[model samples]
Target: MDEQIITNELLKRYLQGKCTVAEQQLIADFLDDPNNLILLHQIMAEQTNSLWDSSADVPQHDRGQITVWQRRLHERMEEEQLIPSDKTKPNLRKRGIIPIRQRIQWYAAAILLFVGLGALLWLWIPQGAKPSEQLVHQKNRITPGSDRAILKLADGSTISLSDAAKGSIADQGGVKVQKTAEGEIVYAAVDKRASTQSYNSINTPNGGQYRVTLPDGSRAWLNAASSLTYPVEFEKKERRVKMTGEVYFEIAKITNENKERVPFFVETDKQVIQVLGTTFNVNAYADEPYDCTTLLEGSVRLVAAHSGKSELLKPGQQALVGNNMLLSEADIQQNLAWINGYFIFRREDLGGILRKIARWYDVTVECPPELSTMKFTGKVSRSQSLSAVTEMIASINKVKLEIKERRIIVKK
Candidate 1:
């Protein structure tokens, strides 16, 4: 069978369950050739675009059929091991002719091609039921988290950043604290010579996040379930801040009275990061096994609180503070994905991923012992609804995820 003859129309017919047996065999043969996978990808993209363009024209009753087709195709592909159930195995097929088992594996690839179309359709069509609906019909749907936090002033007053109007929220000692239109808290020194120096803290609860501009003009982004405490006005000699959970910092350069460079220090439970003028991220959640500091720009020195051990990190390096300080090349994108509105995983365990989901979505996760150690690699937007994110995880990892109230239960 000529691969060119397998046109979009033919694939659409196959998806509609109108393909002849010979046509099905032709698809299987086309998939057998690894080179044809590129063609399949192109066809899927084209089909997805076509469906999106004509989605409004699709009949209400037919939309349900589309959803069913997508679910079935996804299930069939998973059953055939086409999606690579075990991510650790390597593909051993050559470019030339293959054996019967290899050909059968290629048939799974064909199903995956269609499954991709179905998944895209499910995302585009609003009428299509969400993946969570298949598991259990719930009274309420869980939405995604957003920008929200609480600011604690030096006077023991609390301001809700989420509900506070966009203006000057408070005055801290000699500093003017204003909330910008973009929802960032900015601190400006109105009286640098004022005698009093007070402390203020910003805290993000579960399912919340916030950004702040400090007195020294440095900016920090706090991830969900994080907190940062700093002086309302930086002292003349050095700037220091204490933080928990995860936060990204871009330190501004400043000089003291004698023109000497002022240093900045970030304190976590496990370590203290000394910065001259640099951008870095600190993940120090107490629940996690280790505290990690990733440097994005400039240089920073990480000193362990207990062992007094220290490591200097360059722009692309990371220092992991645990039993011993381990320094390695960093995955900058993965480290900064939260601030950039993404959850990027690289062969991370399911339990670790769920912990992140729990913090961002403010939900409890019940992971069976057997599934906790399973590794997965994928990227999902932080803005997606809880059900959407879980659906992607469940579909790709071939697991069943049930949402009961605010809890996610993972099953084999």
Candidate 2:
């Protein structure tokens, strides 16, 4: 067997959340190998992780933790560049008229200057003009979730709240369903329902968002390209609902026949969030890479379908489920701000934030590689244009942002 095969297997196991004490030590030992050291860049480049847009800024404490990791990544990359190499070649400029390092610095500066200038400069001087050379990898800003989506019912009824009148849709069980003209889909129970077999659902588009209230007095907010399959009224024993995309819930307190709190379940593609009477967010968008459950108020438990691993989350905690599972506590307030209509990024990674921004803005993004590793902390309104928010963020981050039509590209 090839030595690299053993290394790759170890990485696979690690990513699968199957690493034991012995296996972790094995991976550490293999990483010390020269061959593995060379492959570290490849591994980091290809590995993928999961995230959810709360549309809120990261809390101060969480931002600090992320900043430490960001600095560590930067330092590691800097050190890697210092590794001794025997592949150095002589300079081809001016027939060895100057030192190689000096010539390189001079040429690099000239090339950078030309690119930083404009096409007008190109009209004058075509030579020594490096075509599309990059300087630093600039991290980008994350846009908030969009307010665009269509609502489809199990009965084949479609509600386009993306650009429609926000007012009473129907009066079922004496419930007043209205839109606030702000595109917030809401339900108010003016009359009580003794019989509990009715259901309703809200869905979001690739660049949309919405909010609604259940007949049982509970509230929910749906994120971009997401939907919630919940009954108008819950039942005894347990309350269950299926979710696609993302939705934040404020479950109503239920004193059952036994006077015990019956658990509420948010069912998704791969896992289920079991709750009794609490507020939390479930982000399980089909368009996203993975599913996430972020808890805000009260206690909740996440049961992973694939690994059979169960996680209990406290208020202000989050669980990310995908090819692997990662659980961490976050700021509940900042993570669930979507219900209010804005995005708050607290020292978030460029690529990480952009993924959410891309989904919300319904736009494609291409940025400097360095930008992907950098982090930003800020706030922007999702109510305005995506470009408007991007400009605000780019200005603070010392990056140049351009919007050619709907596409957003960042330059340094």
Using lDDT, give the best candidate's number: 1
Per-residue lDDT tens digits for candidate 2, residues 310-332, read 88888777898876678887766
Q: Model 2 reaches what TM-score against the true structure? A: 0.57
Q: All predictions: root-mean-square deviation over Cα?
A: 12.2, 19.2
User: Model 1, 105-211: lDDT tens per residue?
Assistant: 23223333653333221111112222332244356778778899999998898999999999998876567889999999998878765433688999999999999
Give the residue spans of candidate 2 off by over 4 A.
1-149, 162-167, 171-199, 286-290, 367-371, 396-400
Candidate 1 error regions (>4 Å): 1-134, 193-196
Q: What are the lDDT figures for the candidates, one per model?
A: 0.72, 0.58
- Assess candidate 1 and give its lDDT: 0.72
